[model samples]
Target: MTSFGRISIMACLLALLVACGGSGGGDRATGVEPGPTPPGGPVAPPEPDLPQASPTPYAEAEALFPFITAVDIPDDGRPLVDFQLSDAANTAITDLSSADVRFIIARLAPVPEGNLTGNWQSYINRIEQPGVGPGTESRLQATTESNGVFTNNGDGTYRYQFATSITDLPQDILAQANSEGLDLAYQPELTHRVAIQFSNGREPANPDYDWVPASGATENIFRRDIAATPNCNRCHDQLALHGGGRVEINYCVTCHNPGSTDANSGNSVDMKVMIHKIHRGADLPSVQAGGEYVIYGFRDSKHDYSDVNYPQDIRRCVNCHAGTATGADRDDLVLTAQGDNWAQYPSIAACGSCHDDLDFSRHAGGQEDNSRCASCHAEDGRAGSIQDSHRIAFEEAREAFKAEVISVENSSPGEQATVSFRVSNPLTGEDYDLANDPVWQQSNSSLNVRVAWDTRDYHNTGNNADNASSIAANALTSALPRGDGSYSVTMPLPIPDASVGPGIPASGSGVAVIEGHPAVAIDDGGSPASIPVGDAHAFFSIDEPDGLPVPRRQAVEINKCLACHGSLVLHGNNRADNIDNCVSCHNPRNTDRETRSIARTPPTDGKQEETLDFKHIVHGIHAASIREQPLQLVGFRGFTTYVYDEQTVHYPGRLDNCLACHTDDGFSLPLAAGVLATTIDTGDDHRDPRDDTVVTAMSSACSGCHDDAVARAHMSSNGGNFATTQQAVDNGDVVEQCAVCHGEGRSQDVSVVHRVRELP
Candidate 1:
């Protein structure tokens, strides 16, 4: 787990807000009720007079902008791809001109479970479903001195046959790799494009399609013969729609600016530096001083970001767009734009970790001005520059608390003993304890000392293994009851000596000595600076002279709910499968809307709100489809809006699986978790248990199979779409309340409203 370092002073402010009240109005509309329809019976809205498109690629992208005003991509989704070339105007690119080009494909790095990289790119594999069109293609071909070639074959119409003896490794890439100590082993040339004659050449129809970036300067024709992944469109379509213009579709060019030169140096700005500097906003004083923090393109486009608010301290590039830390693409460091000295321009420490002392202010003969640093580091920061750069700053250490061994002596050598530690949170002031006070969850705040002793290695026979029986033999497990403030743990030490055998040191004690707060920096009085957590340590004993076995102590990290509970895109798969994302959307607003009637109160009340044991809607829909549990779509809204589409319609994102992020080993860590249920409550009564008040349970809105037209209609509509006329009458006009583009009538597409109502 990446160290969040100290809970910078800024995080304290956020914690304060959370304490003052609940997170303010984080919930979105639960339903989309359609407004009154036209005079005639419901008809498809007139085809919008979308911007006319010229043959130019730029014009095409611009034309599509009007329809995608609201940002459809969920928040946790990768940031929108910016395509505007440095020094380029807001205008879109109309040219597709290239001297020579070849199609290239590359498989994205696999996403591991629960990791951010996993969260961002895991959907690629989720696309292997039936009936959906092919997903995105991946492959790379040869490159010229300056031009690289990439290839893409249409779905199911392409082949992947690799001819033996074909020159796979491009000679030039090999040469460059050899000289630079870089690995470019995968670079190759396509022997030939498989025949395009499809056995059944059927024109498959699917709204999901994407442009595979072309490589090489030479012209070539590449056709995909296999089915592509449906999830490909999830991000691509979102990028296009968000951009609102065709000239803006080259999202790959955003962080990977095709040709961007740095402000101060003659070198080009690499992807790593750009992304790092962007995400590390506050840490960079130059950036915090009203720097133009832009990613280029997607501006003035139609994205409904009205609800997409972020924490005040925006994360630096690596925070989200991490590098090798998450096991993502290691070459993510390669700069897209090239300059005389592009290879070693800047790195993470140089760019992402903005320690302003690296600037001229600390250098000799450097005039102490914002320009002092920007002059040499960021050129755009020059006087009258539109684009501003971030400045780095350092924080003077208030105090550093390192963990020290107060005392450690075995009462009976290994039979039983008590460890005592007096740890301190140095940042604490006379008025409060940072951990106990509101600052506990602050960004920079941390437990001064997290010392733990692990005998797992001592008793186990295998490498780094633990002896289950031996562990049970000791009282150490019982002594360390997770959150207990005391540090000393007593248990039976099987071996009298702390040292292990030859390979394994009999000195089997393993402990983590946590000390002063992690080094943390923040936006200064306009200067980028860092402060060190003063003085801390951990002390223990072992049998041998070698280092003792250590048990790593992990600090408590808050779980980000939006990771799996926000936006979802389902194309080839069942769209309604996005229940996980939907829950976050439909869940009631806890911070606002005080309901007088207890029955209307939101279910989320710091309790076990989601009862995973029972699911009525799932049974109702699938059962009725297969002729099992028969129930008519109930309520006015349901009948009009909640039509079920198994293939095309899908849940916005991942389906909520209890195990996806939770690991209940019976240990209750600091994070929120499911409570142990003693009894199975299949109670059908809709009443609040807190009080004897009448309450609407999730069973009504999300579980029951009631055949109510109004309910069905309401459920059918999308959260931000127009509610059907009947739904509007029942739930009120969604237009005025949530639609990003409000209009007098429902001229826009409100099909989502219809979708929710068409339940079985």
Candidate 2:
């Protein structure tokens, strides 16, 4: 017998046993007892004695209680369903009346055979074949009056008779099916789906629980395991729809199947097409070609997703439909059944749903064949594979220009220190001669080779105030090319004055930062894309009398940022892709005065300056949406203002999910005490007001996100203002008292303030 026939036969047998008051077998396994019948009135059975258990141990219990065990659609026209409502211990739940149960019956139409022509009518015609017509409410006999009525069998089971004709379909739909030679009475190919929602006297907060029999079916043929909900929820926060009521993908697919279409837009509402078009949004070729994708829902309300831009690269299919990659949760795209078209075949309809500009006639010759797609687009395919097509050239070739700092000679400050370094392509293991190769020569002439010297004891002390200077060079002064694939540059180092000491003890241990960026062009069958191939010094310390080489404390993990940004490139893409390198330039003492236009005037009331402090700038940029004032920054080009109202800069994930981009207790309070104060230009416009303000380190980071008037006032009250904090610090004031309340273990700590509460 066929799979459906076997399922139907088994369902009938189970229904028969329940009707005759026989236990549906397997009582010992469930620890359930068959109840005795009562006298006279239909002989009601006694409730089974159940063991006391936790409120929700359903996962461990493997309980099949309160289940719609069997649904029977007889050939002779009678349609009914048998239900067993009980607790985890198999005690029958007779307290639930018929009103407590709600049922929805739907028909599962098979996938269309041919390619879906863009014409809506032609698509509908293909799905309207014999026993394959649209499963509308009228066709499925789904009406308030036609709802099944429950008849308690008095033996821990209930029978609900549909009391409707098997062929009870709308005239128009029935005529279409009949014309296509439909045998409605014996349509074994057409499957039915039954959904049930029940309440067991739970509070309104818990409300009712819903289940679909076909969704939970053990038989491989019946279960629908397409894109799981959790996968989508990774980015969407929560994949809820239909007025935020329906959340399950199983329930959504039932009505959004091949048979479904929007009556208002006359568009296919199939799950594959709808979801693809929605996520692709404004990027869809059709939408870019001056067309809008509008889904008309209940009351013909239109949902135009033309402005919805997906956060990540949409070409990264594995981001959503996970594969056999490390860290991936599930592989939903892998086909589990033969006839599941979306999983089994690469069709024009599915692909064109996103790439709407695809010329179907030109590509397929007006044919529906997609069998050859796998040959080129398969996962393992090389050149023409989907992965290869979307592979970013720069990301693949990033290691080509890797550089390392070899040594820093001449320990004393006043002497000419010799800094040695080497550059090599890690991918090819070829030593890159900066003075020889044309590309390297061009990069050297542009002074891409940079070296910075700073005291290792004081992290982020790279301002003009601290005797620190960075030098850009075209070639090494000595030009000593060693046999070990290394080169040297001798340059005069500024003498460190012992009297010019800050809060930290003046120590001789200094750090040397060597970085270089070489331009490389990668042709990946499309445009010849030019990108900066770069690397930085891991660590190189200058020997000092009393100072010890201390590296900067870890704050943010660059890998975590790359998880979303793919590659974190900033400052006109000249900077190396490392947080340590970024911190070296974007130190707390540095400001964007040189980059800012000297001719431009400041706003009358506020300053027109930009703080390049990594902590302040990074936090402010990410929290720009909540700021009351604009985040103005001066760069290589000119002044730029990030006004949240003017431009949208959405941080893809939850703001309070700090671990998404942080590591090593990065967000922990009681920050490094002696960190330099952050400068803030509280200018209303691009112009500086010359009233630059300096805030305490902690205050600057916190105010980036909490930049309201009240927060600013609070900071000001605590000697943490822009203009006064620096003066207070100079006068030996305790400006770092921010930790009094916002420190770790305090009542109002950073964790407490940024804590994410569950949705109400």
Candidate 3:
């Protein structure tokens, strides 16, 4: 997710601007049924009263496009990156964390009027920073850090000291170098000649910019190539391309034109089909049924994807597009069309419902010339040419473990120290079967180590604990649960230890934090399954030996602890006297809502007797009227008065708790044994324990606001619309559509939440 420039000048300007168009209007297919509206869609009409500076509508200059240009990775192994920004060059990039930049155009001339050169096409290719990846030893210059600071060493091979102008570059590169024939007409002109070359050859060749003969020690920062806003090819042609390939439209600029790239795969088919069609439209369902398939976003805004899921009945091309796709696989590119066999038609019906043990109807030897899918993903068995089969396959398990951070073991109450490390899980012998994976379906290869300590700076120190009970007894170490497999747990120090009963600190030390979760590779939202890895923490620290004494450790990064624990009412510190271990799972099982109890079965639409448990006087009278209201009632997805931050995406809104479940304990005693009450209050002075109360005997008669004949037979439990027997208990009725289906746990009657107390 980082990028700035140079991948053969962004793959020959993304295949010569993929054939430019979208001067802002005209390509409307907004989906979800609005199909017929885009020719001028999102509401189009005001072109007549123009004149006064008539040059805005490239769809209103693409709606003022402030920012959202992501393309990040770009070292030789191209994927595309050129993102632009203009403010007449004041260049105030706002944020994608520090504006991010990089360069290397070399020579691209066209300035006809004032002072422009022509017929040049050079580019040399060698700036390297958007997200580092090529070999490693040549060190002309390098530096990295984010949030903690020190960003942009000129884009890795050096060249981003910031500041630039030349009209801000983007008008689809004069229509992508006039479809590669270099046409630069219109009120047009160009120079883009950058070359900062550094590894200390004292700023190598700068005939105003052209350095690419490296040896180390980098610097080059001169930038140019501006002029966009002609509705920048209407939303960068609906982003998410190069990968899923195809759909920045216009047959994707004929073949990604402008002195194009893809020389048998240096990559440029308009940036590898827009990054493989935006990671395969992040796994569609028409973009996850409106939730937009996701990985995240920023090329112009709105795309978070709330954790992409999509998997209700398989689809997603053998992970990287047939011919078996495996050369290790992690994705950089893998499909190979042109003559179309995609391993025999619809890729074997999208992998026959989960590899149905692969028979593809006898390998379709009946048609669709699959060529036997290269016998198993072409490593060397042949079927190559998707540019020799899309490269990247977990690079030796991604360079087998080298992660660092080797020490930080603070602890003192007079003194005590012991923190350890050693972890590995390379797997080469292949005796596999960790339950065929869903992250071990539910733990078996279970290797977890999460120790967090700082015991709030060793509480009252002096070796801590002295009968002073409760803060968890001085707190230091207690969440230990090791499984058998790859085992290890030294546990033996604590200059202080001993809390859950007297002064809480559990151990005699100040800092004993150690972490490790490892298990990577996972992909089961459903079907053509994938599970290369999972879990991974790895953080390290362990000093306290050279003559004893090192009490202060620090590592942070649970995404900065979700910015204040994802807030909402002391954020779940909701009592057993404040966070009683979050009532295990937010209360509900015993009896609260003033000892609630009710029922009356019979009515399976027998026209009477219905009334189920009414959840503790209806969630304790709407949670005591929203804790006596004054504005604190947010719940339902508003997550109680919201608050998020995520660096500044902000939220601060929402509320709603209602003891989570009319809880004095929870789930109100199996709904008082499936209710059948008329008036039952067996007294203890109404359960007096400082007045515990339960009231009943008809709370004020009239059967407490009627409904005596069982809430109209449980609201006609479906029999009212009858179609009957499709099964999970009726499967008949209709007319309920609470927003078409309930939220989250989505259930429109698959046993209506398990037939709520079925005595009917």
- Across residues 538-592, which tens digit of lDDT does each residue of candidate 1 receive? 3354443464433322211113122322212121111112222122112111101
What are the per-model numbers of colliding residue pairs? 164, 8, 107
Worst 10 residues of 3 by lDDT: 1-10
Please give, for residues 152-252, the per-residue lDDT of candidate 2 as tens digits.
66445665555344545446645644554432332334345554444223311011122223343335333344455555544433343432323445445
Summarize candidate 3's per-residue lDDT along 296-361 as a digit string, tens digits. 111211233222222111222333233323222523223232112332222332233223234555
Winning candidate number (lDDT): 2
TM-score of each: 0.26, 0.64, 0.21
Report model 1's TM-score to 2 decimal places: 0.26
Model 1 stretches astray by more than 4 angstroms: 1-255, 261-270, 277-292, 298-694, 699-760
Better of 2 and 3 by TM-score: 2
